[model samples]
Target chain A: MKKQTCSRILPLVALLWGVGLCACGDSAPELQRYELRLQGTTSRFSTTYLSATAVQVTLGGAPLRTELLPSSQRMNVANATHAHLVAHFWLRPEQVREGALEATVVLDDFGAFEGTDGSAGFVDAREAPLRLKLQGDALERNGRAVIHIDLDRSIGAERQGSRPLLPHLRLVY
Target chain B: MRLKRQWLLLSLLVPSLAAAHDLECEVSINEQSTLVVREYPATLTFRQVVRNIHPTLPSTLQEATDPLLEPLGWSFTPPPPVAIPVNDSRTYEFSVTVESLEDCARIGQVPPSESVEFTDTLQIGWDQGMATCSARVQCVPADTFVCDDTLYVSSSAGTSTELMPLDPTTLATTPVSSSTGFGYDAMGLSHIDGYLYAISNRNLSGDPIPHVVRVDRVGNIEDLGSLPELAGQEWIVGTIMEDGSYVIGSFLGSQWLRLNPVTLEVLGQGTLPTTTPTAWAANPLDNKIYGYQSYLARMSVFDPYTGDFTVFGPVLGNVGIQPCSCAFQQDGTFLLYCYTSDPTVDALFEVDLVNGVATLLGSTPSLAAGDMASCAFPPAQGATPAVRPSGYYMIHEAALERCLASGPVKLGLLPAVVTKEDALRLLWSSPAFTLGGEHRSEEQAARHALARQTLTGVCNQRLFGGTPELQRLLLDTTTTLGRTRAMSRLERHLGEANGRGLDVALPFSLRGRATPSHALEQLQPRSSP
Candidate 1:
């Protein structure tokens, strides 16, 4: 009889605790999403080069997440208009000071690393910090980054005699 | 000597009117007449002339051969009709025919006979005179290899099992050999070492047995007997590899059976990466077997040694959807001939290896059930043939690599974060189903099938479309255990990728139970590995 009474009270106590946690939902962190696109330069980023390029999102120079776009997001890299990598990170209400967050999107194009026996790393430039402001749960940024770098035509480089360029990754959030 | 004595006695007995009349005669046989007993039943003719040099002596000539010529079947037709008038010569010809193997061998004996002689008797007004003529006999042997550059085809649609040589330029065909009493369903017509080899489903006795047959140029056939490995399979694809090993494959299954070219013995049998196409021809340029899927409108290259298949993207033209044939053109271009289901739509196409486009060359003869073979090298003509780089294999390999890198994810093998680990685990497993453990093998087979499905999917995407069975294979998931849940979502994504365009949702782990602490913990940087 005593064990049965304890089980009955345990459910009531657990229900009250779940309610208390739900009541403090205002302090919960919400995921902020952003779409990253590559612009500038005459180079066409083929599926192979796009797949080989590693995209990393860092907060205060600390790496938050790293992903290969095609493998991670299943984006159509060959389609120029649809070519873009999506990144996500969670930030608390208090952490969104001044209604903006400064994050650096690093794109490492490994086009030049090809034929280096996997011994070579990134061959091109990294982007500066891009400022992002929250519009609900999504991050919005104005203007795209314009950077000068080598061309990347990895797909037809051999057949077309297109030279392998040190493909630069541009950040447009 | 006895014949000469008889003639002298005849002259002595004839002593009528013992007046001696001047009589001169000469018997001559053409010395340049040669006999070559090449492939039996040979006949050699010898021309003989009897001259009457005595101005008034008219004579009738009688000829007798040496005893050695009796066994050689030497005989005169119409008794030679040797009657010579004054100052004239009577010339007659006789043939020596060799019928059996023994006689042919004797005719070709070493140190050819120098004493093979024939004697002639002349009757001049009851006064007999004799003269003799001698000649040498020489017979050379036949050649073992008869080289031909004619293109050949063995079709299953015709009623005759006779193989035909096809003129690639005009699409004309002439029977290379008489029907060997086998059915016309013989496939895999390949040329190897001056002879045409093919796989016939029916034997000479009309038995439904698959056998290897070698046919010489002049209609003689050497049946190499039944192949036990390919005993029951029908419509087997066959070709000789660059290394000269015979490759027998199946249209429905992936079995690649290699046989020794000379012995017709099994060299090796392994599973191919894909099922054999309807028709196959080895490219002399690369020594790889090229196959065409008339239904799918795609061309694929198969490496016999490596057992790898690199399927080129589908052709971009109106290549027929019926049974067709393929051979390398004289100039080393990929040639295709197809007789469509419509009786009048016979067409030939030249496929561009790099672009995967089929250009219509012209209409072809009725090749509804045709498969072709040719010598890799163009016909021996003026100078050494300069072969430019086809670069076909390189294009195929590049397409295969591209498909492998993106096809799986594009086909929803790894659509979401939850199924990524499982999909990758299954993708990395062995494709062979013959592994020992049952459960493990089933899992491996599932992975293998998925990998194949992915390969077909990517190649099909690059192509116009493909066989229903290929599409069914790509969509089939009954055996992929626990994947039913993921398949529905995969189908949605596939539709999105195929027609609806871009996918709006990202593949992430945010939907399920996520606390603020868990979310913040993901953002925190960890120590470098």
Candidate 2:
């Protein structure tokens, strides 16, 4: 009688334990989301650097800083991962051109990792150029970033088939 | 035994003409006082093949015809008057009227005293080339450790791939797409426009690639049909052509058939020039197809354009060359590899396309060279002939690396050279019930009963020539065991031993103390038991 009683109660305890194990496996970890807004400027290399020496860049609305672009670029933002950093930038110019700026947003660390392969810690970039344009007095999106490229440009100097050079901006943790 | 008996007769006559034994030719006295020269009967074969092309009599012919005598030169008279009696296809007798032996010599008629003018009767409609098969090998990729799927492999050292299309710094492989139906083989690359091809030996009313299987560039599978000849023959193999056609190796006899790749339609079928080559080499060294007849060990070099063969070789005895495979190169030579199960050794042989002479360049490390695939390449210095694989091999497939939300997921594969990651690989389906496993195009298959299949290179099963009754019995046995859940004991009781007292009802069982073996002795059939 005792053995039977013990056997009957053992199954009940086992079921309870199994339920708790299931809950623990599905528990969620704390997650935090962050975002980085990137801003940049652009200008025609020939028109802007004619009588000048170097270009400059600035974060937010801070003081202007020198910047440089690297070659061997993957030409894409997402594929740039695992690529070596080309070089360091230097601020060389005191004189500034008006309206030569652009902006973009990015999330650094999503706080928590989840799902298979921790892909839960990723983000998908839907923007094609994530680029910008620069103008005197106002920094704007450049290279037909807003409108379709086939529509033809209206503002910059009337050029045959060249797009104005754009600056770089990155958001990192 | 027939061959031995014939050889015995020759040996018995050898003492009369010691030097004549060295001369084996087909010369006869002609009525024009000249000598008539002919090509003698010889055994031609391919490498990796362990059999010989069997010669049957006129009864084996579809319409019962006599064998044709190939005339090579003329001697003694202007060739005797030929007489193949209309209603009788039995014998071929020529009325010779030779004036003098000197006149015959001028026509290259070797006298029977100094040389031999042998006479032989062989079956027509089939090739008489003899050959031996060799082991397989792996070679390519000048230098690399990465894996890649290659498109075609030439007998020479030329490989094609699309590894580095954009960047010159990384793998520089040109993209080779099969979307155009362009295929690679032991011959050069070929393709056809406006048609899909199927290969088979299915023997189906009209199914192509039935017994054999095929895997396309993207790994799509198809079945080829079987043949009607060589009843129950199996292990059919073949390749594709430029005009959406395929040259398939038949199962019953040592011959090749030109068929549609998409529909299993037969355009034409022909035999090889010479039946033999060095080890592991098949013939018909046409622009596209070269195959080895498994049982006959004969290699057929087919020229689909002309529907003819140019040369044949004698059988490769023990110390002779084994023709296993032939991979066409851009130049004149083709990469011919040898495979053997005896020692599990495989080698790469550089075979001269025109001459049919093979030279062993190097060998591959022991592996499963029984059946393999590699991307063909153009010839290179020092690598002009068959180059041995350098250490490791590449991945035998074209693994398309895809970056998913998960890790890198590889899917589609393209043609690439072989190395550590790109070992030569083969793509094919199954031929459990298919035919030649290769068909022509839809237009071709639409005409034949066995169309729409591809002749796969799986020549191991006896699909068409096995005992169906036994197979049915086996199936029934399997089903019965499944139902009863008892499979340990299974035997066929072909009624009890009739002479063994049936059920042992007689006192002392009729024979009194007869043993089981003795009891059945009386029931044994007079002939086979």
Candidate 3:
């Protein structure tokens, strides 16, 4: 009788163990990871005091990262893919009167993301120089200007890229 | 062996069961913004929405995490860890108390700039993750120390000998014990060094004497002594100076006597420019005494150093009220309490020191003529000495520099130009020139030279041209001097110039004329002339 009981119990235990292994396999899998970074460089010859208003990172025309005044110092893009970064600045009146002009370019946004299977991610490795060129006289102008820094070009550069690729910043006003 | 295996299985099952049901909470506060006075507590209500995210198993909501709000003097009652049902949400409320202003500063929650919004966060935690809620608290410094700044009024009409304390802000009255044996008429009352000094009719002869007495806040009067020099003076107005001395002004002789605050003895004596000074107060901003002359209905500023009194202009309001009393605010603004016979108006006014314009604040409790005195608990520690610009040009230049340094320029809002005529009027009305005897002419000539220099400097800066600043300056000058004809002419010229987008200039012919006309003439462009 004891031999018969043991035989029945062994098969039941084996079935239970098989079911437990299947349940463990059905749990959610871990996510993947990717990196997106931006860097900006101001023109060495530029002497305009720049007050930035907006900094944003867009993925396929959709914003992945955005910051408004007065918190426009930095932006963080989460789960970013196919992203491009841009910043907006203005020439204030006091800057004109004081005759102390200067321009600042900021790598406003940085992001880390996990790519889905077969999805396109940030792949460019070449560090290209994004130039800021000033057109009009900043001291005589009063309006807005924009700086578009290519994420692929800013990948390997330092977070605060101070080296100027152009001679002057482009002032719309 | 079997028991050990069972115990191991039970331990694993227990943890899994506990982890299955987790709490999800969202915390919020009732008021987003509050203004708290120091040492005064303000209430804050916190509402927390707690939900059980478990699929099937029911779990009890346990204790929440510390909100870390102790630094702000915020405390909560009914310590957390209340139970919640599975797949259902429950709202929990808690009270937060802010103790003092010092704690508000320590918390570093106040905004740096005016109109800038600030938020203080409170974190509430459950079995799972934490949720944070924030409230904006704007802590304002309260005048909590103004308990001693009561307005003391003693009735001169009726037999009611009580010195009543009136709330300076509200004009509410509190009754005190009777001053039975003290005196009938209290002429002037001033609080100095925790005691109230009154110039009352408390002499042995029962005459209107300038007998000074010490009165406590509770209306207990103590006879200090009598001023022998002012023994028989009537209708005397007394003011306390910043140096703790009493300046008693007598209406009979038009004399001002400086008396020792403690002994009530005359320290020095001088004559006033005007005959009767009905109201007077020492301006803490400039340390100068200011008074209203009842006879002339003029506002005068007295320089204690030079013993010079300068009359600015006619007092703004109806000055028919006899025995009006004036007191100075910490900001140098004067408060005038007066009783008018016509319609029996007992009104309190806030006087603008710059223009002597009295803005009616409200009516007092009684319409009867009474002696008014004011005291503040935490007395004003006198602000930075304000230099009264001698002439209009000096004032204009200072205002211009301040406007430039502050922000964007608004040319139309520039200060009015102090013309030579305005300076002369101010100088001629001064006691130094009017009462200086034989030296008046010499002083006048010197002042005239100084005025010319100021005007020349201003003209060199292109401030006299057809600019918006000049137009506004001319309008203000005409309005202040009551130059009706000149004001009408200038207004017409200005309107025409503004319509054509042209600037106006002050004509050279009208430079030094009293009631100057042709002050605003259309300026030809520099390209033309």
Which candidate ranks first by TM-score, i.e. highest? 1
Per-residue lDDT tens digits for candidate 2, residues B1-529, read 9999999998987544322211001111231111223222211110110111122211111111111122422121212222222222322333322222222232223321111122211111111111111111111111221112232322211111111111112212343222212121222111221111222223323433233333333222223334453233222344444333455543344455665443333567665444422222222223444544333444445566576553355333321343364444333345555564445555555555454555666654332212222222221111111110100001111111110112321111212212211111111100111122232233222211010000000000011111212222233332432311122122111000011111112222111121211111222122110
Task: Quote the lDDT for B316 in model 2.
Answer: 31
Q: What are the per-residue Cα lDDT tens digits for candidate 3 across A58-136?
A: 3222222223332222122221231223333332233233332223333211111111221111111111122222222
lDDT of each: 0.43, 0.25, 0.42
lDDT of 2 at B175: 31
Per residue, candidate 3 scores C-alpha lDDT tens digits across B206-312 of 55545676665445455565656766566457666665566777667787777655544455688876675677777767767777776666777886657888878
Q: Give DockQ for candidates 1 onward, in order.
A: 0.00, 0.00, 0.01
iRMSD (Å), candidate 1:
39.2
Could you estimate the TM-score for every candidate? Answer: 0.36, 0.24, 0.32
lDDT, residue B138, candidate 3: 42
TM-score, cand. 3: 0.32
lDDT of 2 at B129: 12
Q: What's the lDDT for residue A28 in model 3? A: 21
Candidate 1: tens digits of C-alpha lDDT, residues B210-259: 66766555655556677667766764567765555677776566677777
- Local error of candidate 2 at B522, Å? 94
Off by over 4 Å in 3: A1-173, B1-148, B157-160, B184-192, B202-209, B319-321, B365-367, B376-529
Tens digit of per-residue lDDT, candidate 2, span A27-68: 221111111122212221111110011123332343232222
> Could you give the candidate ranking by lDDT, starting with the highest?
1, 3, 2
